[model samples]
Target: MIAHPNGTISTEVSDFLLNCLVRSSSWNFWLSLFLSFLFLLAMGANGVLLVTIWLEVSLHEPMYYLLSILSLLDIVVCLTVIPKVLAIFWFDFKSISFYACFLQMYIMNCFLAMESCTFMVMAYDRYVAICHPLRYPSVITDQFVAKAAVFILARNGILTVPIPILSSRLHYCGKNVIENCICASMSVSKLSCDDITINRLYQFAV
Candidate 1:
């Protein structure tokens, strides 16, 4: 239902997309199955990495601590997303509920932002370690890393909270099918028969 810039409204496109997905042949199923299996396997490997990090006392330095955080984030992220995606491939319930869809988007966005921020902070640490070797120990302390992690999480949490809350309040009429693999904000807004200028603007801002 997105209102085009030309003052035209987008027709409900979910049914058409759903039909196409439904009609996907055996090859599509196999491809999806293989990919989902690979994703799950990757998650398992990350879990092993996490366990190894925990068991090794020598891996308690700032860099390994960051790696552990990364492992934890990877585990959480895959846990959040991969299961549902795999279910869609195996189960019959392909459609995600509106609230669930938005929630997924919100969580996914929060994690993505946090990951970006964490990597950026890690890069800053590396820069300090390389470019200013003398002050690196004083500058990138454990407290600083903890603070940076907290800041990253808090910033993303604050910025992403409004998305689900605001998008959930928007009118959707009868359109409920999502075309993409996941129910993203853009796709959901596109289902509306109302003006989605605000949604698009917010999406761009995010």
Candidate 2:
């Protein structure tokens, strides 16, 4: 039970309603449809890129491996976020269960950082090829790409696991309305009755 301002108590929160981006007007609903179409397009393109890279042995170098990794990240991000956004806007299926919300929080946090690191490595790959062309083949090998992939996963997973855990440990106190389309750390933490400054600081530090 959770205490209220007037000496009352309420049951614990079990689920959260995902809010639409624009609930104030019905006319803006079409924008959600448009954005949903764009997400679908992006996912399709990335899917094709991944398939092509996997099928073509000639594209098995560091550059294409890094590109495929970025494509994989895009697909994951779209899969995690776009479907729920579409559901909220089209079908009004806004209620996300408590555990599911936190799970989404973890995946979103982890994969986004991985995607950024992948991009950074990709830029470095290009830098090596253009500036240090003589040593490019030695420095940016298939094994180097593999190690980078492992590092991205390990680093991001270790760092971001704490985000959802820390947020979930807070006292939600029966508040269940999430003010964002996605289960972002800040949005979820703000629903808690306890202090969330630590969450904010950790998120910023990461």
Candidate 3:
């Protein structure tokens, strides 16, 4: 339940309305179709790349392994934000449940961070392979790749957990309309009546 700024305790808010950028009815229709098509194309390409990498034994090296992880992360990111965005654009289905919103926010933050970390690890792998050719085989082993994957998961998963938890704890006494495509941490935090200084700073830190 949200306690209004005027001291009235309102019923628990089950969902939040997402105020998507819909300029006009016709615009929304065309935009949604285009976005949906793009999403499908992206997913299909990534899926094929993943399958090919899995099937071909020659592509089972550290570079291709990291590329596969990147593809998986891309697929996850697209799935996390694009479906709801398409629904909002097409049917004006903007209402997202409170817990669902938090879940989406957490996933977006964590996955993006993990993706960035993956890129860094990939860069380091390339650097070692090129800068020190002889030692590359020993340095960039399958065990090293496995450890990198685990570190990426652990670092992002644990660090980004607090973002949603902190936002969920805020007293959202004001309007519940989020003016964005996704349930971003700052977007949700700004709707709260309580102090959001910590939320902002923590998000910046992350």
Candidate 4:
């Protein structure tokens, strides 16, 4: 996939993730079952980890606290797309409504971006604590961490709103059927019959 200076294209990351989400029919029903089972196992493990961390006072340190947050985000990410993805694979939902697609796209992007920012903040925390132990307490306070988490969520959340708003406003003239498994920005953009020259230019610029 191509990379840019500021950020990589959404489709590139989504494409890669979708590939991991899907499996070939050659893998057989049993293998698919086993893989799904394993996914369920991991989800259960994370749930247990969250409960243990929450219920046990000893597990409430900064590192574990961040880990708990990460685990919760992980579960949200999986829940966001996996069900629709599995439905597409097992059942039949060839066409998703524009509204549903937009909602999914925005939400998936918001949570994913939030997780990325959270990881970056966690890295900075580790660096401060390990590299400058004496000053770590002053540098990373409880309020500071709370604000950091809110900043990550708010930053990602605000950026996602425009994507859906822009996409939903477009009028699809021709074949509404999406070429890909999921409703991607490019796929949706390509379906629009209205003047999209500006949109295309902006997309390329991004």
Give the best candidate by lDDT: 3
Q: In candidate 1, what are the lDDT values of residues 51-129, reduced to their tens digit?
A: 8888998876677777777777777777777776666666645666656777788988788878788788889889998
Candidate 2, poorest ten consecutive residues by summed lDDT: 20-29
Itemize residue pairs with steric clashes in candidate 4.
none
TM-score for each of the candidates: 0.84, 0.93, 0.94, 0.77
Give lDDT: candidate 4, residue 199: 57
lDDT of 4 by residue, 21-119 (tens): 334665535554765786698699899999999999987777777777788888887776666655655654445655678777777767777888889
Query: TM-score for model 1?
Result: 0.84
The stretch of ten residues in a row with the least summed lDDT in candidate 3 is 5-14
| RMSD for each of the candidates | 4.6, 1.8, 1.6, 9.1
Task: Report clashes for each candidate as comma-separated counts.
Answer: 3, 0, 0, 0
Question: What's the true lDDT of residue 34 in model 1?
Answer: 86
List candidate 2 segments past 4 Å from native. 3-8, 24-28
- Alpha-carbon runs more than 4 Å astray in model 4: 1-35, 195-206
Off by over 4 Å in 3: 1-12
Q: Rank the candidates by TM-score, best first.
A: 3, 2, 1, 4
Whole-model alpha-carbon lDDT for candidate 2: 0.89
Candidate 2 residue 188 C-alpha distance from true site, Å: 0.8
- Candidate 2 Cα deviation (angstroms), residue 155: 0.4
Error of 4 at 53 (Å): 1.1
TM-score of 4: 0.77
